[model samples]
Target chain A: MMRIEDILMTLRMFQDENCDVRTVTLGINLMDCADSDLATTCRKLQEKIRRLAGDLVQEGTLVAEEYGIPIVNFRLAITPVAWWAADYGVDGLVRVARALDQVAQEVGVDFVGGFSARVEKGATRADNALIAAIPEALASTERVCGSVNVASTRAGINMDALLAVSRSILDLARRTADTDGFGCAKLVVFANMPDDNPFMAGAVHGGGEPECVINVGVSGPGVVKRAVERLRAGSPDLNLGDLAEEIKCTAYRVTRIGELIGTALAQRLRVPFGIVDLSLAPTPRIGDSVGEILQMMGIGRVGAAGSTAALALLTDAVKKGGAFASSSVGGLSGAFIPVSEDAVLAEAAARGDLPVDKLEAMTSICSVGLDMVCIPGDTSAETLAGVMADECAIGVMNHKTTACRLIPVPGKGPGERAVFGGLFGEAPVQPVRSGGEDFIRFGGRIPAPIHGLRN
Target chain B: MSDNSQDFIIAVMAKDRPGIIAAITQTVFELGGNVTELSQTVMGGYFTLILRATLPAERKESVIKQHLEEDWPDLALAACVRRYSPERLFEPELDTAAYFLTIQGEDRPGLIALITRYLAERQINIEDLYTRTEGDAITLILQIHPQNRQSAEHLRADLQNFGERQGIAIHLLHRDILRATSEVGAIRRMVRQGGCLS
Candidate 1:
């Protein structure tokens, strides 16, 4: 029998602490739908996705209701389009992207990932075409998200692909200039991308996955922050180790909820259950910031002197707790500090306390790199590629997943606010330090580090 | 008196005292009874317990009652005894999911009736219910199982609307989540075993 106190505590976490399942993504493999004719392939792809994920939103709602936990987003992820659609050029890819957007709308999903290319080692003809089509594809579709994997520990960083992605992101920004470069928000450049991440704009159903599976992303930074606060109030003399233990315990509970809900949903859908991504992904809500979790850990402000240490402690503890809670823990299971998505981080950026470099430095220890960051509109494509290269280098060297969803709002300069609204939130454009043009101009692959030569 | 052993359902009620369990168990033991299951709780100034015990078929229910009343007269304990049938030994497995519903509002009459009536009308079973009153505020906690066919979303919406009308705050959550948060080890074990806890 569950104790009354325990029931009340869980209820309070949901009602007051903002504990929620961030997403329930249905990953559908579109590889089998490929055809020599682009139109036929797009049609087959839509039909397959519609058939497999038609009930996704409804089932997700039912599961969320059954658990009394809010599932904020119901999303879809398919296999990377580039590999199977090698014959399709930019125009054909755009058509496929539109079909994906339509299917997402018909199925009532928030976003459809896997309008993607994996060019970590090198770009194939198809990968090159897909990379070129990203700006138009994303700008033309509301729900289609694009990702490009340009680096991996084993394969080294593809600087050539990075340059293309950077230029494409700028084009996407220009195309959606009216929405404060919102099109760029739907695109992510990744390094060592996970096969089972359920979070967007970087989620993709990798080739190794089953035909269809359900992966859940659980988020509860507010709960962790509150737990720390309560622990501190009760035992003021507790050290950092004690506090880290508390965070781990909180993460365990959070991940358990995700697993429970995900299992039930998968069983109902009669699809294979993938993994629960135990990422502390925050929204624009006031109390739901990863930066706040750091603050509760004794940082006076986010981006302070000890922020990286705090983030490292937090990410490590979260992963430890998640690993203990579930056997199939995958994806980027750590804290996400997306600037515009987190109010505190956005505030720190606005106040000039958190610069682009500090945010990049923190990502070395946290989850995902340079997420939801807004840079000045005039930032050059080479500079953008430089940013991507630097962040990708961190991922390659550390053997971790890193991504960039940098938005360069058109006509918006540093100190100006770019509002994407909703979960994308709003943030002041951070100034980018230039002078990396020469480095990015040398557009060739950076060979994999010696550490990657394990085999 | 028969050759087969008999099961007795026993209830004990008394003012809260430390030796009540010892005295009761000792008497049962003396009667050649083996305790099978027992649950006890204290409310207000009184203690209550229910137990299932098996005794030799030669003993009668009245014999145990009379012995308890006569031997523990000074303690002023009340004992009720009944025959426990085999059919009642095993509880049916509950396959449906469990949820915890919490309600809080200003203390008022008919609050419990209103909530219970709503659930009863919908065929939602309340597995365990508890309520406490402090000054003008009343809090209720209920473990509920939605009927197999009932839609949880519909029920949640109805309950939320009802709460709005009645000026009460209601929160509903999965029972497993509560178990996971409060007793992490129990949830871990359940997950590892690939089973749901009742």
Candidate 2:
């Protein structure tokens, strides 16, 4: 029998700390839904999605209630439209995006991803069309998300494709200027992207995945933050090693719940359970931010001297614990430091303590690169590509998945706020300096790094 | 070590003291018995123990009771012994079927009777229970098992309403969750078992 203290402590982690399965994303491969005619393709896509994911939300709710944990969102990741519906140009892709949005609403999902293009080495005709359609597709649809993979360790950075994608990203921001460039929040640019990520705006059913699967994303930044706070309150001499162990134990428990819920949900849906991603995805709520976890680690102000090391500790401990908790762990299983989504991180940016430069430095050590960052609208396309290029270089060299969701809030400058309501929260526009315009305009591939050819 | 062995149930209660369990087991050992399953607790000023032991088939339940009373007369604790059989099931499948029903509120009376009656009417069994009071606060924790496939949601809703009426907080959760968070091996064991039913 479990002790009464242990039972109440676990309940406290839920009722107080923001521990939840952030998303239970059902990945459905839509390669078979291809058709030459646009309407046929749209109908086939919608029908297939409805057939597979119609019961996802209801079953997810049942599982959440049974487990006594919050499964906050139900999302879908379909095979990239660029691969299947790419022969259809920008207009056709936008229409496909609309159909995806409608079906997402009908099936009661929060988001549907994989309106994406992968032009790592070079762009095919399909990749180009999807890249062109990204701005309008995201702007026109509510729940549809897009991602463009412009670099990889094996194939190096595709500068040409990245330049085109940056322009589209800028266009996307302008198209939703009414919401302070919110449309760009639904798109991501990645280098060496994971095929099985269950979070948006980068989630997709990659080519390597099964036909249909259930991937669960669990988050508990607040849980870890509280654990650290408890340790600090108990002993003043508590060392980093002790802190790491505390985080590892907390993360292990959270991952166990994620895997349990994932297994139960997969059984209920009758699909193979894909993986449990134990990333500490924070929300706008207080105590739920990875930034606050750093604060609990003795960093008084975020973006101070040791923020990167703190983040590295957090991200590594999370992965170590999650690895033992689930045998089928994949996706981006590290701490997310999204500025706008995390309240403390956003406030730090707003106060100029966490600058774009410090954020980029943290990107090298955190889960994903430069997530949910708002930049000045006057920042040039070349500068946008430059930022992507720098982050991609880090990922290519380190063999980690790095992505950027940089929204240039139109007509907003540094120290001004851009609000994207709900989970895509608000952040002050960060200043972007112009140092790499000449290099970005050169527009040629940076060949794969030497270590990338280890195999 | 002998094949011809019989199991005996032992119960003892006394004023709370140190070494109560050690003395009872010592008495059982001298009687040529081996302790198998035992539970002991000290609440308020009273100590209580219930144990099951195996002894040679020759030793009867009355003989074991007489030995315990004779050996530890000064202890002044009640002792009872009985022959054990496997004909009756005393507990539900505890490993999987256990849940915790917790009630917490200002100090009051009749909380257990009120909640237990509700559970009894629904055919749900309360296998074990514990209560603690500190100042004006009181807490009752009951380990319950629902034999049939009952909708936990409905039970929760009903409990919430009852809690509201009584000005207390009542909650129910699976025991596996507590075990999973507290024990490192619990989760891996669950994955190996596979196909977990709610």
Candidate 3:
């Protein structure tokens, strides 16, 4: 005879799948917060962020408790600051970043990103200044995060910007080598950057977002992974469809928890509710990799046969479950393959089995593109330009968000390993196969592909 | 020609062209061999193929290798004759796990080897990986499973410290790949004109 508790437990097994909350990102719009005077700009930026985000941490905690979910991190994503700092130059930009940091501390957010610019096709003087200031800005400010968009599906990749950004990342690291380029931790060079992403360093209030909206990022890679393991243990005969069904069910529960937390947080914060991003955002830990999930599906390696199909299934299942959970589900709601953020992915990178090209291929199906990859220090800027071009083409052609967060480790090459501590794992600094400086000298915007002009 | 217990495994790499499959399959058929398993892929203009076949008792691995190499010099062929593992013939248990890992750093060679060697030593298995390059910057992913029952978070922190010294960002976490099917039961009851599962 089964006790009532046992029966209920069996029926409620899915509830455990929904235990994680993806992100509690506080959105701060910086467009109206800047001033001509550097001091005024900094003060305004600080006041605005502090005023808006002051209650964010407490509210997020209350909501997490109410929904019985773990809100992993409290973060802030502001409007891209490059545009506002166009007239102020690097010095002025640094001051704004300092103010941003102060506000982040006051609000108790883990990270405050959005010192960014959208330049998928080309860049202006302002964009250049911001990109140039990356190393210093990140080193100078503890919380200010920066991301520069050098590629987009419609406009292709800006080779010039990519080359420059690559150099900027390297310079930033070298300047702060002692800090493990922790400043680089605050930077993400993107293509097809999302507007509603609630994950920091990359999260920014998209152009399409509401002025003040509360969004959520839900994570449950552990829940789905456990279900797969259980299914395989219980029944060897289960097919791929059976596996997919389990994934969807797990995702549904996880999505519901995220919605519950987000809704509760918004109500308490007295802000308009926004989308819930159901991204399998992983931390620097084992057993939490999206790539490991694909491996579990029987593919010998990450880039091998049936990889895309598996990713598509996972992405779709997550979206389906999340959509059903909330009417306002939006943002990059899919499995994330950020390399530096997942330990399993980092290990595969250290092995020869995974390559940068394979990572690019997987991005076609995953939510984001080739991210947190390392290359040889001597790699010519042109090679970086080419990679950016290829990734941007994928995003524009497929009409999806793609990004590149490449690190040019000083004094390293293919086959040599570098270990970046804490959340950023170890990586094999893959050497570039190409090294043509001539291509980068072309220096003109690649015309937006005809497809982008389409509706 | 009456060998019932002999089998041959063929591994071939060649430039992809027309009739490659037909040529191989036809060769086996004409030679009175039964093709049991086959897998092929075309990448970077080269075609890679693997085949498992049962051959007549009189045939040997050397004979097949000799004949194939002599007949088709254009096709780089390698053959090994051995007893087949029955487990390889059937799908293994469908157990699956998913995870994410992050590694950041100054560029170096053999970083993958260093990390994977650790996993291999600990009985952890790697599945898939994704990496991107912008100039010298690199970020990569490795999906893996641990054979031991250690805490995933503990492993991640250790790797993180390792990465910090080398300038690599390391983050590892497991992915939940499936959910329980309680809701499916509700659907079954609602559609009870002989439910879909039944």
TM-score of 1: 0.95
> What tens digits encode model 1's per-residue C-alpha lDDT throughout A19-55?
9999999999988888999889989998998899989
Give the DockQ ranking, best first. Answer: 2, 1, 3
List runs of model 1 lying over 4 Å from the truth: B1-3, B86-95, B117-125, B132-135, B146-148, B151-157, B182-198
Q: Going through the candidates in order, state the TM-score of chain A alone for each one.
A: 0.99, 0.99, 0.92
Of the candidates numbered 2 and 3, which has the greater DockQ value?
2
lDDT of 3 by residue, A1-455 (tens): 11223222322333444346757887767788767788888888788877788889987775454223467788888888887878778777777777888888888987888889888777888888888878788888877788888777678777778778877887886776664444665688777788888876788876866667787887867667777887889998999889888888777766655655665577677776677788887767666677777777676576666777888888888888777655767777888887767777767777766688778888888887777777776666677767766777788777788776777666777887667776667667776678556777687666666887877
> Model 2: how many Å of interface RMSD?
2.5
| Distance from true location, Cα of A204 in model 3, Å | 0.8
List, residue by residue over B38-129, the lDDT tens digit for candidate 1. Answer: 99988998998999998987788888888876788767889999888766432323455667889988989888998999887776888788
Query: Residue-wise lDDT of candidate 2 within A1-455, one digit each (tens)?
Result: 56878777787788789888999999999999999899999999999999999999999997777667788999999998899996788899999999999999999998999999888999989999999998899999999999999999999999999999999999999999999999998999999999999999999999889999999999999899999998899888888999999999889999988887887788788898999999999999888999999999989899999999999999999999999787878999998988999989999998889998899899998889999999988778899999989989889989999999999999999889999878878899999888879999998798998888988
Worst 10 residues of 3 chain A by lDDT: A1-10
| Residue pairs with backbone overlap in model 2 | none
- What ranking emerges by TM-score with the best candidate at the front? 1, 2, 3
Off by over 4 Å in 3: A1-18, A179-182, B1-198
Root-mean-square deviation of Cα positions for candidate 2 versus the true structure, in angstroms: 2.5
Instruction: Please give the clash total of every predicted structure, in order.
Output: 0, 0, 104
